[model samples]
Target: MNVLVTGGAGYIGAHVVRVLAQHGHTPIILDDLRSASYERIGDFQHEHVALEDTSKVMAVFQKYQPEAIVHLAGSISVRESVQTPEKYWANNLGAGMSLLLACARFPVRIFLFSSSAAVYGNAVETPIRENAILEPTSPYGSSKLAFEHTLHRSAQALGMCSIALRYFNAAGAHTAWGVGEQHDSEEHLIPKVIRALLTAQPVQVYGNDYPTPDGTCIRDYIHVVDLAEAHVLTLENEYLGNQHNFNVGTGEGYSVLEIISAIATRLSVTPQITFLSRRPGDPPRLIADPSALLSHVGWKPVHSSLQEIVNSAVEWELVRC
Candidate 1:
């Protein structure tokens, strides 16, 4: 099948692109290379274009005639979203609307969206279920939720189906491939810690005043490989409902300090750390239940242990350094 992967040159998108290729599917990647590095895509068939470009996006659609689209493009930072909400709206919701229109015009079948747990905001419970209220705190999350609605309406109008995977932190690297987490600003907790350790800098823990244990935020961290596998399996699901949404995670919550401890244990070195003030829009805890995805598609996270997550990330950081 010809699959169109937006932002295929990105961190998680690249891994999904590789997984699709391994499954004997032709992945036609489309990326603007603004926030993502092109080299990480690792020699896949790709086009240098943003999804908002109707002319170019349509051109690729006309050429490849893809069976499905895995949309992973747009802004993905809570901190940055709080600072620059315009970028998040323009890139996330605005771009998503354009992409959905194109997909509807092209008459694509399945549309798999890489949603985020941020859509749930600071949930009232620990393990957030799919039925949780859609109350996003940050503009980044709002943008994603906005696109989810756009995808739903577009898919319904076009007689197609879509799946939005509202997973949590996508940590860890593909140990075999070595193309793991690479962030320009390093806002993510795992990669941020790795880079700080690699550079011999004091690890800055943001928002240590949250109401969680150790005064740090708690999150459901999923391995990038496992996250990629869920995307692959989404293609095989026979959903009776056209609007299928699921939470993809290990069903485990780990605090920020817990992750640091795991990393410190894996690397066998004490990290120089400094606790900083909380960033706006950061939830105290965002843990995914992941039961819906598990029961529906039998998708399970294989390498999502905090120890393994930190271990694989350390290896990738070492290799990157």
Candidate 2:
């Protein structure tokens, strides 16, 4: 299958592109390189196009004529989204509209969207199910959920088969692929810990007094490779139709302290720590019920263990250093 992966130069998108290539499929990347590095994307064929530009997007779709598309391009910072809702609304929602319009014009078959667990703000249930109420506390989550709603409506009317994988805390990196997470102003916990360890800087622990084990917030951390494989599997299935949503996670939770300890152990270095108050809109615990994905697609997370996730991240950070 010929695939067009938006944001393919990103941390997760690069891994998805590699997974498609490993499965004997050709993937053309469309990335603006606004917050990604081409070095991580390696040797894949790519086009420099912004999702906001419909003409450029249309040209890429026309040129590639991809059988499927994996959309992962968006501004994905919850804190920043709170500060500037317009940016999230414009980029996440507006860019998604442009992409869907281009797809409608070009007539693509499969669309695999990179949705988020943020749609289920402060889950009322232990392991968040697909049926959980979507009350996004941040504009980032709202933007993603809005796009998902549009996708469902479009699929019904346009005969487009789409799948929105609402994933939780994406962490870790490709074990052997050498493509790992690299954000300009790194905000993700795991990456931040790795940077602190490498630079011998203080690891800022946000909201250490949350009501959870070890007095810190807990979240589901899925490996990049595992998440990438889910995308490939969703696209490979010929029976995919209309619109479907799945939570791609390990169905387990790890606390912030646990993650810090794991990173410290893996790197054989103790991290300087400073506790701070909880950030606004941060849920205490957010886990997923991946049973739906397993039953529907036979997809199970492989590298979900905390040790494995931290190990991979430590290795990648060492390489970067």
Give the worst 10-residue stretch by lDDT in candidate 2.
234-243
Candidate 2 residue 232 C-alpha distance from true site, Å: 0.2
Could you tell me which residue pairs clash in candidate 2?
A: none
C-alpha lDDT values of all predictions: 0.86, 0.89
Model 1 spans with C-alpha error above 4 angstroms: none
Estimate, for each residue in 1-321, the C-alpha lDDT of model 2 and write its tens digit: 899999999999989999999999999999989998768668889899999889999999899899998999999999999999999999988888878898789888988889999999989887999999999999999999999998878877778898899989899987588888888888999999988988899998889788887889999999999999999988888875567899999999999889888888887898889998889999999999999888888899898788888888888887874
Residues 104-218, candidate 1: write the lDDT tens digits.
6788889999899989987898788988899999999998998898888879988888889887899999867758888777778898887777677888888778888789988
TM per prediction: 0.96, 0.97
Q: What is the lDDT of residue 63 in candidate 2?
A: 91
Best by lDDT: 2
Residue 148 alpha-carbon offset, candidate 1, angstroms? 0.5
